[model samples]
Target: MGKVLTQDAQRFMVDCLKAVGAGKKPALQQAELLIEADKMGHHSHGMNRLELYVNDIKTGKCQPNNECKILKESEATAWVDACNVLGATSSHFCMDLAIKKAGKAGVGWVSSKGGNHNGIMGFWARKAAKEGMIGMAFTNTSPLCPPTRGKQPVLGTNPLSVVAPGAQDELFYLDMATTAVAFGKIEIQRRKGKPLHPGWAQGTDGKITVDPEEASKARILLPLGGGEMTSGYKGFGLAAVVELFCGVLAGSKYGHHVRTWSLAEGGEPANLGQCFVAVNTSCFAPGFQDRVAAIMQHWRSIEPTEPCLRVKCPGDRERRNKEEAESKGTVTYLDSQIKSSAALAKKLNVTPMQVTAE
Candidate 1:
């Protein structure tokens, strides 16, 4: 493992994005998105994804300088064309719009087409939460997860996030991929020379496999519950719901129509779909934040099934991770990540990230 100062990591990401043709604001915004993932302990979406963004820009698949436009709007809803901008730019614009509309209308819904990969969905959802409203974010990606009992992938991980702010700085935050695991986890395991855990993926033969290489090659992720008997179909259903909100509603690439997930190749623009929603709690109830905080506290007070492992509320782990990273002022990366980032910097002719002593 290698440790890097948080600012250095952000700078490296910004530099890499700029080197690949992204403008200053777009690059910095995108880098902020990636760095937040690292701070929250989601290594898969952090620096791990920098090369993919660079490739997208290099191949002209993403136009970081382009402007997003509203195609249609009502009192509480909007349809946006992201115009193939960087995911951070598009997501910030949409979520900000949602929050603004919710301030007056009590609820806001915005669906967008032509987005690129947008780091972690939770980051976007938390934006409205900070404004004392309930927030939701969803996005469609390249197809990588198979429906329950199916051999072929028909949906992306199709992540969703919901966040609500509470009193005393408490929160109810839930963000998850519909699949058993995000594809980035598989890539991380492969990078670490590790095997997959059972129930995570299937081989090309459609049977469960613990081999990371096989899982990566097959590109078939299981639904969250793993198999038919385990109710994996529930997760499959959730992925479909996200797709409905994103691709189907937004009229972008949907389901199998989405492109393949790849790092080495850039084809047509992803034209991916995304959705954001905000609901002003003040419109429906008073003391909303107090109630939310109480419930989270109650959950934490529950008896643990294992004494050593206490029960926690939805956002506790991520909050703890962020606090720890902040206290240290550093993020840790795998040796492979460090080496690859160095190679990327050399390729882009940008200054490499400086590592701190562990």
Candidate 2:
């Protein structure tokens, strides 16, 4: 493993994006999104994704310079065309609109089309949380998950996130993919030369497999509950619900219509669908923040079944990870990641990121 200053990682990401024709603003915004994921210890969505973004830009699959525009709108809802812009540009635009409308109308909902892969859903949802409102974000990606009891993949991981602020700097955060695991996790395992955990993915024969190579090639992830007896169908249903909020409502590419999960490779644009929502907490019951904080505290105070393990709130782990990263001012990456980044820097003709021995 190697460690790089968090700032250096962000700078390298920006340099690579700029090298691939992204504007200063979009590159910086996208870099911020990725860095936040690293800070929160969600490495699957952080620098691990940089090369894919660079490839998309190189292939003209993403038009970072294009502007997003509202296709239609009402007092509390808006439909937008992202115009094939980078995900950060479009997501920030739509989330900002939602926050503004929520300020006036008590709630706001925005649906968008033509977006590239956004790093993490929680990043967008947290924007509203910072404004003292409840926020939600949802997106549909390339199909990699199969329906319950079925063999062929038909739905994306279809992630969703919800975030809200509470009293005393407390926060309620939940971000999850409907699948048992995000496909990026498989990539990480493959890079580490490790096997997949049971129930994470299926082989070509539709049975669970621990071989990372086979799982990555098959690209068939199981739903959150793993299998039929475990009620995996519930997860499959949730993924479909996210699809409804995104592609179905936004009129973007829906399940089975989305491109295969891979580099851009001269293919058509992703045109992924996304949704954002914000609700002003003040418009609801009184003492909302206090109630939220109280519940989170109660959860943490519960006794654990295992003596070595402690109870935790939804976002506690991420919060602790962020604090640790901040204290060190660095993020650690696997050796494989460092090697790949060096190769990417050479390809893009950008300065390689400086790493220190750990």
Candidate 3:
């Protein structure tokens, strides 16, 4: 593995984006989105995705400089066109608009279409939380999940995130995909030459399998519960609900129509759909933050079922990861990631990143 300073990693990402014709601000915003994921230990959405973004921009599948426009609006709702902009650009635009609207209307809801792959839905959700409001975000991705008992994949992992400020500097955060696991988990296991956990995915036969190789090739992700015996269909229902907030509401590519966005770059624009919502807590009774903090505190104080582990709230793990990463001032990448990143820099004619061994 190679360790790179976080700031330098961010710089390298921005440079790569710029090499593909993204403007300064857009490149930085997009890079920040990726870096934050790495910082928060969500490698699936972080630097692991830089190559895809670079290739998309290089191939004109994503327009980093395009301006998102509000197609229609009311006091509390908006319909937007991302104009094929980079995900971070459109996400920031919509989330900020939602926050502004919530300030006036008690709640703001925005739906957008024509978006590219937006990294980490939680990033946008946290934006509203920073403003002392409840933040919610959802987005549809390329289809990688099959409906229950079906042979072919149809729906996406389709993630949702909700975050809010809490009392005593605590926070409530939840970001999750409807699938049992992201396809990236399969890739990570495959890279390590390891088998997958049961229920993580389905094999070609559309049944649960533990072979990483087969699961990756099968590409049919199971819902959260895995199979009918485990009530996986309920997880499937939740995924459908997220789709309703995104592609169905935004009128973009829905369900099976969304294309598979693999590691390659030469396809049409993703044109994914997304939703961002913000609700003002001040609109409710007083002591909202205090109540939230108290609840989180109660959860944390509970006795652990296992002596080696302690109970934690939704945001606890991510917060700990962020704090640790900051204290170290560096992010570690797999040796494979370092090699690919160097290769990408050479391909894009950008300065390569410096790394520390150990």
Candidate 4:
């Protein structure tokens, strides 16, 4: 039988976040965002990140309850200073503020500075879509991917997300990292002693590698499609665009200017940046909602070649995972993840989730 666990992972994560530094509803909201991602099978952005956050807090990279402040604002644009706030909380606040601004002006753009790594971008965009606004968000992270012609890690696995609202809380969403695989996913694989899939990364000496530990230590990830001949160029270009917005445009670090957290060294400075925009499709054309509905309907109506596979929209898989996790109580985490959480909680003087009876 598969391992079983109890307690809503969201609540437990929230408790731990609160116990550390999150300390309020914003932190709780951020915790839920990550927990939801894990439950929905986006393991790359899930509970595995908790240890990183804990290290961030302990090392002063993330502040507890340090709400970001607006550095500037206009009818359709804004800038925020995260004040070293947790990325999940800060990004959510920024996106909500943008959505509110867009409701008044029909569009809003906001760039943020000094934020830590937020969870998945789709998490925030879906919020705006749910509120009847078209949502888009982008973020930059520590350099983990090599540029098209370069061998060293210089660009972040910058991500982009877009969401459109539909009938019955249905949503059309696209959220993707610009890399073939995020470093976090690679790290998880390394911890589990698993091999990286073919075409995911290159070693320091510019050779393809499948050993996760080796990949983590001395390799750089390829772009979304693996190589230029395989459409990785497109993903590389998109990642650069986001970097321009979050780094150059926001006046923050770009390329290899970021520092990453490691368990041994504790939290270190990561001067990251991000951008978010909300569009009121209603402003662009009448019957925009109907048009979106039609577009998605047509996409989903496409016939599947294989009977076992069904047409899937960006957010569909995640939503289905959410349903399964809700019914099953807690999400199933790898043993390493369980131990990591326990260690962090013990260090912080809080009760961690009991992963197994042992």
lDDT by residue for model 1 (145-205), tens: 7877778889989999999999998989999998999777888899899988888998988
**Best to worst by TM-score, what's the order?**
3, 1, 2, 4
lDDT for model 1: 0.93
RMSD of each: 1.7, 1.8, 1.4, 2.8
* Candidate 4 lDDT by residue in tens digits, 140-196: 887888876678888878999999987645778898888997777788789799998
lDDT of 3 by residue, 217-333 (tens): 888899999888898888889889888988999988888899888667477888999999999999999999999999999998999999789998998999999899999999888
TM-score of 2: 0.95
Question: In terms of lDDT, which candidate is stronger, 2 or 3?
Answer: 2
lDDT of 1 at 328: 92
Question: What TM-score would every model get versus the actual structure?
Answer: 0.95, 0.95, 0.97, 0.89
Q: For model 3, where is the 10-residue window of minimal lDDT? A: 259-268
Best by TM-score: 3
- Look at candidate 3 and tell me the lDDT of residue 234: 87
RMSD (CA, angstroms), candidate 2: 1.8
- What pairs collide in candidate 1? none
